[model samples]
Target: MLLLTIDSSAGASVALTRDGAPLDAWRTEQTTSHAEVLAPAVQRMMIGAGVTGADLDGVAVGVGPGPFTGLRVGLALAHALAEAWRKPLHGICSLDSLALRATDAGVEGEFLVATDARRREVYWAQYIRDEKGSRLVRGPFGASATDLPELPAVGAGLGLYPQELRPATMDEDPSAWVPDAAELGQLAEGALVGELHGVLCQARPLYLRESDAQVPVQMRQGGS
Candidate 1:
């Protein structure tokens, strides 16, 4: 099967997998570039792999527990392509993708998979790594990373918070923080095989807190 996976929640990543092997992959840290670069990036991978929209068997997307704008851009593109091509659409949790990446990177024990959610908070999750896969142990929460309850941590971007609050054992480097597309391919496989849920409706963004737009005008006015 030919699968195209997209993740723009944390960083922009695009991957093309055939069967279970990644045929091609590309990523960019273009935070504001999703709208302009997504199509071209996907096209480059397709062209490199010598595949077309008609060749895609499915569209797998990282439906996010991420910031509103970046997450929506990737989701909208995935849905648009899926509908236009009449291909099946599958949604994968961005946090799950992070968990999968952590496991693939050899992180064991408990993990707090996280991505930078601006406003001094993070879109985060707590999971345990086992031979079977990662199991969510605590949260898919949005809160000040500093306020995060104590837990063993292994994730990217630890510097976002005070050193005292971060997981003491996890590496505190930016390089350690990016999500992997290869694991995304494996995640897509599980979803495709029905071992995981593939329904789009149920796969809604796990935004743990109320969005800025959702805040009432009074709250905005009063800084509540």
Candidate 2:
């Protein structure tokens, strides 16, 4: 299956894959520009891979534990592309993409896939790799970086708060934190190629916390 994958949960990446292997992928190093960079990045990725919208079997996306605005950009585009191509869309947790990276890099024992959720907290998921694939042993939890139990940590959360925990080997690789669209594609290629209905039927954004734009109850109650 030819799959196009997108993820903006951290930096933002677009990829093309066949079966479960990546053909080519693109990512922005500047983390804050998802809205500005995502649409064009997707276009470039497909073009570079020598594919067209019609060439895609389906779409896969990172369903985030990320900020409201950034997370939605990728999800909206995935939905639009899937609808445009008339193909199934699959959503995978963005942290799963991070965990896959760790497993691929040979991180042994269980560890945390952490990403900066801002507000001094992180979006964390725990995983252990077995022969099948990585398993989520704990969280898709959102909490203060300090609150998470100590494990070798991987992801952007460590970059943001160096004081929080012992860094995993991946912490040295800057790209480690950014969700890889290629990895997202690998995770969802099975659904795209086979029974799309049985797995993720839609590409949905996973915002684990409320939007920053939402007023706190105390602040709202005092407002005229």
**Which candidate number has the best lDDT?**
2
Model 2: runs farther than 4 Å from truth?
131-133, 169-176, 190-202, 215-224
Count of clashes, each model? 1, 0
Candidate 1 positional error at 37, Å: 0.4
Per-model TM values vs. the true structure: 0.83, 0.85
Worst window of 10 by summed lDDT in candidate 2: 193-202
lDDT of 1 at 101: 61
lDDT of 1 by residue, 133-171 (tens): 667776678877777767655455465664724553533
List model 2 lDDT by residue over 89-165, tens digit each. Answer: 87888887877778888887788888888888889988876775557786688999889888888888887878876
The 10-residue segment of model 1 with minimum total lDDT is 167-176
Clashing pairs in 1: 156-177
